[model samples]
Target chain A: MDPDELEFLGEKSKIMIIPTFNKENIHLISGDLGPFRASLPSQVPLWVATLLKKQKRCKIIPPDWMNVEYLEALKEQEKQTSGFTRMPSDHYMVEAKLLLDCAPDDIPNADEVKVIIKDIWDMRMSKIRSSVTKLVKNSDFYAAVDNLTIMEINSVRPILPHALDNLFRMKHIEQPKPSQNSNVSSFLMSKRASTSFQLSNNEDY
Target chain B: MDLDDTNLEDLNDSNDSEDYVHITPAEVLELMEETWVNEKFAPEILPNKTEVVDIILEQIKSMEVNIKNLSNDDFTKNIYQLEVDKLRFMVTSYLRTRLEKIESYVVHILKEEEKRVEKGESKYLSEQEYKFAQDYSRSMDRYFNKIMNFCPNLTSDTWSSKVIEPNNNSFVFMKSKKTIEGLPIDITNADSDLVDIKSGSRVIICYSSIEELVKNGDVNLI
Candidate 1:
């Protein structure tokens, strides 16, 4: 397998599991976790390992259709523990999840996926930069931060240098053009001329 | 008390009568001699031309004294009073010299009158001519006093109207000159109130409102 393909398969093969300590009702779902694991970046495994270590007595099981309700409960618990109710608008979570549902053999080219992610990230960053510039100009930085949440999401694909450069350039903003009035200078000049005339006349006579 | 005496009774009766003692030219001449006894001076048997000039000069001096004393109070301590005093002095001096000349002329006229009377001439001056002379003298005296005392500065002509455009927002210029002593004073439009400017020893006054000056900023200098 290509190194990139092997990395993709290894990511998909990993699973995240949660356990209930009590044996009175044991619900489980076991499935091919490859695609789901592949959907997450390498950081998800570390999160899963930490969670499992923290709950040592609970069982860790594979998720399947038979235990869908249990999986949902686990997800709810994870959300509560992480204190994150929803993904931010600019996050690529939904798209990543959609990709996860596809079979590994049917996955889009890694480069193609990377391109899509970069395009989305670039677009999102551009919007944020514009909004930030406007807020700063208006002296409304606090309001802007209160209205929008900024977050970081990891991706298995690397962002292109050109796309990164474009996003960085967008941050360097320009001030709006001032309104033009051409006649004011002329009026002032004429006034000055008249004053000089008056002064000179006084000196002459 | 001596009424029993004939001469005293006659004197008392004469004094009580309607007819009073009259002074004749002979008596006047005799009295003049008595007044000038120690001196070789004779009272002019007839009034001389110089005597008339002296009389007029004395009258003018007395009038000036009266006017000066009347205006001595603090209430009269102002530029107007000073001007009045100056005018009075000028007129008095002028009139004194003028009256001297006039007296000589009058003396000549009186001599002619006497000659006409001797010749039994009548109607030397018509009634109208005499009245007109009297009125003219009175008017001259009154005007002399006024001119001497007040010295009022008045303009015989109106100021030229100035037209100004809206954009030309400048001050008005008022040219003032003293009448008695010619002194020029330039007053700008900004100084709208009455301004007293001293040129030499005389004061030139300029009076105008701020509005009028600003409005009439443009004036024909010529």
Candidate 2:
């Protein structure tokens, strides 16, 4: 390969190679494989088991010439990767739950809602079984799930307080006792009763 | 004989009442004038812009003198702690007043500009004037940012204050739990989502994490 192509690959991989001693003979042999190996970090051999699986073109270079640049390149790569990585699933779920609880009135769009549900799902899949069970048993998780489900159901039809109350009661791990302020309850009961009565009348006709 | 009796009777009543009650046209007029004087109408009182500016400048001059005196004082006993506290308070007070003054001045200028615009005068300023205004705003913003960044350090007795203390024996405790043990992790790394489990599992996730989760199928429900 041409030096330009090798340099382009080196830059992309964040690695640089330097030939030593017999530059001509070494360059001729190294040009084929030196750039490829130079493009990888020292840990590449150990971490990447698939390297042996690929067709062998040349011998792997010794570790000494890899130098500080190789280490720095690896560090930069790791930094970039970690900087953009997803937060742990459990943490994301907790954050979503907190946000939803704090501002339930200001419902986020479908996309945002999905993100929260996914975090809960991921937590269920990856977390320790006991921890998962604890989460499943947790009152907050169920409340969040109920709130989300009610919101989803409401997206199709106008939300009735009766439906919301039922959902809350069904899913709530330790449900709070009903209070005297039953404005929402009364409104929902009247509306649902009137609607059902009208439907029955229509069916008889 | 009857007319003379009636006249005599009226005279007697007037004389009796005169000793207990008296009235004069001049005195009534004088009372009316006094009432008018007391209830004198006038326009609503407001400080003139120039007067307000003068008051602020005077207060600033006084503060400058106070700051000068503070700087010159021999605060030897508990000198280090006193100096830092005084300096911080002084700086914060100064910045607050300065910012207020700048804001007021800007408002005044803008109001004038608005009036000019209403009169169909030049709505846009000359290039030089615009540049000057922009530069002033930019400089103020920069100064404000610098002051805000330095505020936490200045106020905290354990952080930058210990460096200037006389004895140098005062142990500067790191308020952040992450730094108390002096772990090998990078300072930037401390800001990452990875919990330092040893440090009580202090978890932090950046905005980027949420964005990524949204991109990936993991957070499809949003």
Per-candidate local distance difference test: 0.28, 0.28
- Docking quality of model 2: it rates as incorrect
Evaluate candidate 2 by giving its C-alpha RMSD to the native, one decimal. 37.1
Worst 10 residues of 2 chain A by lDDT: A21-30
TM-scores for all candidates: the values are 0.16, 0.15
Number of backbone-clashing residue pairs for each candidate, in the order shown? 11, 10
Model 1, span A1-205: residue lDDT tens: 1233222212322334433222121110111112223223221221232233343422233223113343344345533542222322322333233233332222334344444444444544555565445533543111102112223211211122112222322332232223231111111112111111111111212
Predictions' DockQ, in order: 0.00, 0.01
Where's the lowest-lDDT run of ten residues in candidate 1 chain B?
Answer: B158-167
Q: Write the per-residue lDDT of candidate 2 for residues A171-191, one digit (tens) a residue.
A: 321434344222111111122
Give each candidate's fraction of reference contacts reproduced: 0.00, 0.00
Can you tell me which runs of candidate 1 are displaced by over 4 Å? Answer: A1-46, A49-110, A144-149, A152-205, B1-222
